[model samples]
Target: MSSSAAPILLLALAGFLIGGAYSTWKTLRWLSISLGACAVLAAAGAILWLR
Candidate 1:
């Protein structure tokens, strides 16, 4: 885990969570789906960072 990567990883995770929540609340089903997908990608990136 390089120091440089930490911020980006954290940002991605945060964005994913925030976007997912907002999309879900906004009642836009398609956007919610997209946001969920982003969340998955963010999680994968986090896992890769840990490795």
Candidate 2:
């Protein structure tokens, strides 16, 4: 490949990786929230059952 094309290709790859990482981060954040909500509900149910 030509030198000029290499730089542009590398930059594009970097941008694509950054975008993928950001989306993964967002997905994890939502996943954690869902897990936390489930945990809280489970605890509440257990407390009520014990009472």
Compare the candidates by lDDT and give the number of the best one.
Answer: 1
| C-alpha lDDT of all candidate models, in order | 0.72, 0.54
Q: Residues 1-51, candidate 2: write the lDDT tens digits.
A: 875555455545555544554565656876555555554555455455445
Query: In candidate 1, which residue ranges exceed 4 Å CA deviation?
Result: 1-26
In model 2, which regions exceed 4 Å deviation?
28-51
Q: Give the TM-score of candidate 2.
A: 0.49
RMSD in angstroms between candidate 1 and the native structure over all alpha carbons: 3.5
lDDT of 1 by residue, 1-51 (tens): 887688587667868676676758667777777777777777777667677
Among the numbered candidates, top TM-score falls to: 1
